[model samples]
Target: MKTYQDQIGNVLGLKKTPLRIVSLVPSQTELLVDLGLKDSIVGITKFCIHPSSLRKEKTIVGGTKTINTEKIKTLQPDIILCNKEENTKEIVEACLKIAPTHVSDIFTIDDVIELINQYGEIFDCVSKSSEILDDLTNKLTNFQQFIKGEKTIKVAYFIWKNPWMVAGNTTFINHLLELNNFENVFRDKERYPEVDITKRSSVDAILLSSEPYPFKEKHILELQKKLPNVKVILVDGEMFSWYGSRLLKAFEYFKTLRNSI
Candidate 1:
């Protein structure tokens, strides 16, 4: 058996490359497919909609926070992919009972690269993964060049409504904002925090994300009324938050966004 340690230091003993794989994380599911493991992935959560075809062909165990244990058991996967922030401890423990589980804890671009490398080894697709990493590295380099001398705009990125949550420090979204040269107003706070929009009078712009809560044009207009002078724009949540093969396109998106602003 081959022994591998995941990002969180959990050791996995694989008899062979995982054939019947189940992915609980949406971004990781896309990465697996990009690594040429689409057929190998037998199951996924309902949120794994990158390939689109996977939803039709693959068995969906359930949502990210909730899982159908019976459905997962029925799939009889050799390996299960999960994320520390995305999946509950209970789900991880339960998955371990069925097969070797690899849980990734990603906070930065470096961590994403490491996860890709780990997947390469885990799925025996080193060349394909390396190609992806190379492409991502090149794109990020270009973006860095593109953002040089760009004015740093103070921004607040809203991920959810109702309670009004903003992506704060120690998040992948914050890291992306930093890369884009945008100063996050919530940088002092940790994780996603409930924001008092009225108190945040210093922000130059309000970015409404297109996921988790699906912030739309109507929401943007409403927020615009709340902060009339501030620029309120609808941002693609996937480009800002997804830390996988999706990152291949994120830098390019960032370039365009920054250029517009």
Candidate 2:
């Protein structure tokens, strides 16, 4: 058996390329399919909706934070994919008992690329992984060029409501927000934190995400009243947060978003 170390530095022994794959992370699930491993994917979480038909085709163990271990055990996967932030330690320990588990910890695009490369190594899909890396690097370069001269927009990105949480430091969403030249007002804070935006008078705009809470036009209108001087717009949550093959489209979406702003 060959030993492989994950992003978090945990090592697992694999006899061969993982043929029966179970992905617990939604973004990784999409990346696996894109890297030409769709046929090998036998299980996924309910949130893995990128391919749309994947949920119907694959057995869903459960959601990101919560999973059905019994369902996962029954699937009897050759390997399981997970993410540090998305899955709990309990989940990792649980999966490790069943099969070799690869956990990725990503806070930036570079980390995402490394994860892709690691997947290529373990799954033996080097060509496809290289293709994706090339495309992603090119798109990222184009975006950097486009955003070079753009004015930095001071914005607060909202991911949820009812307590009102915003993406802050050390998050994938914050990384993308910074790339879009949007200065997160909550940058000094760590992780997703609940805040009273009305107190943040320096914020120039408020961005409501379309997922994790599905902020809509009505919510935008509501915030507009509270922050009449500040611009409030609905942003695609996937484009800003998903750190996988979805990033292929994210760069293009960033171009559009900056233009609209």
C-alpha RMSD by candidate, in order: 0.8, 0.8
Q: Residue 251 of model 1: what lDDT?
A: 83
TM-score of each: 0.98, 0.98
User: Which portions of model 2 show Cα errors greater than 4 Å?
Assistant: none
Off-target runs (Cα >4 Å) in candidate 1 are none
lDDT of 2 by residue, 68-150 (tens): 99999998899999999999999999999999999999999999999999998999999999999999999999999999999
Kindly report which residue pairs in candidate 1 clash with one another. none
Q: Itemize residue pairs with steric clashes in candidate 2.
A: none
Give the local distance difference test score of model 2. Answer: 0.93
- Compose the digit string of candidate 1's lDDT tens values, residues 75-185: 999999999999999999999999999999988999999999999998999999999999999998888888998999999999998899999999999999998889999
